[model samples]
Target: MKPSKNIVLIDSSRPIDRDHLLPLGRLRDLPEQIKRAHTVVVTKCPPEMDIADMFLWEQRLKMPAGIEVQFTTLKYADPLPVFPQEADKRYIYSKFAILLTSIANPRHLRYHLLSFYKISSDLEFRDHHNFSNRDAGKIKRWALKHNKALIITTEKDAQRLSALTQLPDEVKSRMFYLPVEAVLLRSR
Candidate 1:
C-alpha cells in the first residue's frame, strides 16, 4: 500500500537510553525518515524518559525540511482498582477492552485509556503489573467480539503479554506484531 501523505508514525518503545541510542544502528538514516514524515510523534513516560534528548538527535541529523516532530508523555493519576466479582465483571471487562483495543492517539495512550476505559478523572492505571487475569479475560472477550483485526500493540507489551496462554484463540489469531522500521527518504 502506498504511504499516506497525512500519516503520522509513532514510536513509544523503550530502550531510549543514551547507550541504546548509539551504535549507529539506532541513529543511522533516521533523518531520512523524518524527512518523509509530515509529522512525527514520540510517545514516552514522563519523568522517566526525556524527549529533549531525542529532539537533539533529530536536530543533529538535520531532519527533513517542514517535518514536525512532537512528544507527549503518558501519566498515571490513580489506579482503577478492579476486584474479581460478578457485578463488577462487566465494568472491568469494558475497561480492559478499552485499554487493549483502542489506539486513538499515537502520542498519548493514557488519554485513550482514560477516556475509553471510563476511568474516573481521578483514577489512573499506568503500570502493566497492575493488570490481572480478570483484566486479560476482558481483553480476550473484546478481541473475540471484534474479530481481533491484527491487534496492534507496542513490541514491549507484546513481549510481556504474548506469553499468557489464557488469551482466547480469536485474540491470538488476530495478533500482529509491529516491528519498528526506519523509512529512509531522499531529499526532494
Candidate 2:
C-alpha cells in the first residue's frame, strides 16, 4: 500500500515524561506536526486513552486552527497477562517465572497496563520483568495457541522478527507492524 501523504504517525507508547519535554525530541516537535497534518494517527494508545488534553495542548501550542486528531487502535503484540493475584508471593512468583521462562507467557500485560495508565510510583517492583526477544517469541507462541491477533510492538521488535530465520509461518502471518511517521497534509 502507498504511504498516505495526509497521515502522520505518532508513537503514543512513549510516556509524557519530563525528559520528553526538555528541548529537542519528538515531544517538542509534536505541535508543529499536528498543525501540518489534517489527520493524526496515534499508535499503541491503550483502549481507553483520552485525547482531550492532547488536543488542548495542540491548540495551546498553536497547531493549525482546524486540524483534527484521529486515533487508531494498534493491537499490542505482546499483551501482558492479566494474572489474578497481587499478594500471593507464590502466585506472583509462579506468574513471574512463567513470564520470564515460558515461551507463551503473558506477564508483560501487567506492565503495559500499568505503564500506559501512568500508575502510581508507589506500586512495587516497577522495574521487574526486563523484556527481551526471547520473551517475545514466547508471547508469539501464546498468541498462536489462543488464536489471538499479533501485537504491535516497537520498531525494534519488527526489525528483529523480520530477521528471525526460524519463526513459524503462523507467527509470521500475524505480524502487523505500524511504523511511525510525521508528514505534511495537503489542503483538503
Give the alpha carbon lDDT tens digit for every residue of 116-176 in model 2: 3332111111233344566457655665554433333333334544555454555454443
Q: Which stretches of candidate 1 lie over 4 Å from their true place?
A: 1-105, 108-131, 181-188
Q: Worst 10-residue stretch by lDDT in candidate 2?
A: 93-102
Q: TM-scores across all candidates?
A: 0.33, 0.35
lDDT of 1: 0.44
lDDT on C-alpha atoms for all candidate structures? 0.44, 0.41
- The model with the greatest TM-score is 2
- Give the residue spans of candidate 2 off by over 4 A: 1-4, 13-33, 51-61, 77-94, 97-110, 113-188
Model 2: lDDT to the true structure = 0.41
Q: Write the per-residue lDDT of candidate 1 for residues 1-188, one digit (tens) a residue.
A: 88766434444553233313336535433434546667666545343444566656456546576776655554433223221121122233343332342232333544534454542222123545444577568666655555412244444455655666566554554443233333222111
